[model samples]
Target: MLSLLATLWLAAAPTKDAEPPVPRPPPPECLSSQGRTVCGYQCRSTGTHADCARTPYGVCQVLTGRVHCWDPPRVVIHHPPRSSARPECKESRGNVACGYNCRLSQGEVACNSTPYGVCSTHFGRLVCWDPPESVIHQYGARTPQPRCLNASEAVACGYDCKAQRAEVQCASTPDGVCRLDNQRFTCFDPPSLLHCDHSAPPPAD
Candidate 1:
């Protein structure tokens, strides 16, 4: 009787296979960016976009209209500029003007090397804006001005035909704008400058 009772007790005990573990959503700490406080089960930024996080649960979302999330925690969602293969400016409308023509849709724009005052496409070609006209129109009439500090600055600074890396660092100055790019830096009124290199490598000294 004693041996039989012991056997029955062993049979009643739980085994690993008898109960399956429940899958928990990723931990709050697992869903945050480095050095960021975990917001509910996710990580977020109060200023600019949060740097990419290593947590497997970290996700990036974009949309047409603003959205808020309450499940897990309260969060805001917004849209990002779509990627493009060509040179074009992001318009207020969620579309891109490709090669002097624009179509209102979510996608990339095809670009060419042509300089117009507003980085506009003319006919079916891309052109880089020449100085003065490039400076006056590309920025704005009252928005201060830009000056070239070097040959590279003069030629490489402006709306990049490819949004390439050249580096035109512009800062708001009392007179206008201060800028440094294409290996040069200059100060001007309103203190802004156009700097990008279509052929240069990514941002790094």
Candidate 2:
């Protein structure tokens, strides 16, 4: 029967399996800086913190501040600002401070370092949160005003904290505002600067 109908037409011929695709991951990996602009995939930035994780439980997220991680868990790599550490400056006019015990009155300027680098300031700007232990904070969106910059242990001698990425939202209690850790945003207290809306998608309410 013509070789039994050519073995049933090669077993009813309908086999097309030679698959070898499914590999296209090489885009996202951006890193702007202070102002903000973040992509994804194994990225890295340290103006304060920006890591796009590449494994090791990767999965980071910082909306307003701008940062996008993927897959697994988290990532944080921020160095610098450790020359034995200790900066407690005050007196502002747009001086801007970091860490230590920096504080300016009326105009606002708070300080703190590590143990959750909590800093604060209001009306004029300046905000920070649980940075330093997997840093984050320095968020953007409406983040402007950053003329005089100094660092050491968290301080806003002048301004430009704007919640950044640390995300404390005050309430840790210096008065616990920003909550937990070391707490210290002196200058008469009240007004830790953490309103809302800066950028990305989750800055609405």
Instruction: State which candidate has the highest TM-score.
Output: 2
lDDT of 2: 0.40
Q: Give the distance in Å from residue 2's predicted Cα in candidate 1 to where it truly belongs.
A: 13
TM-score for every candidate vs. truth?
A: 0.19, 0.21
lDDT of 1 by residue, 105-138 (tens): 2343332222221232333333232234223323
Q: Please provide, for model 2 over 83-175, each residue's C-alpha lDDT reduced to its tens digit, 9 standing for 90 to 100.
A: 333333343555444334445667666555432244455444665443322112333211222223233433332223223233322222232
lDDT of 1 at 133: 27
In model 2, where do residues sit more than 4 Å from their true spots? 1-4, 14-20, 23-26, 34-49, 55-57, 62-205
lDDT of residue 77 for candidate 2: 19
lDDT of 2 at 129: 45
* Count of backbone collisions within predicted model 1: 22
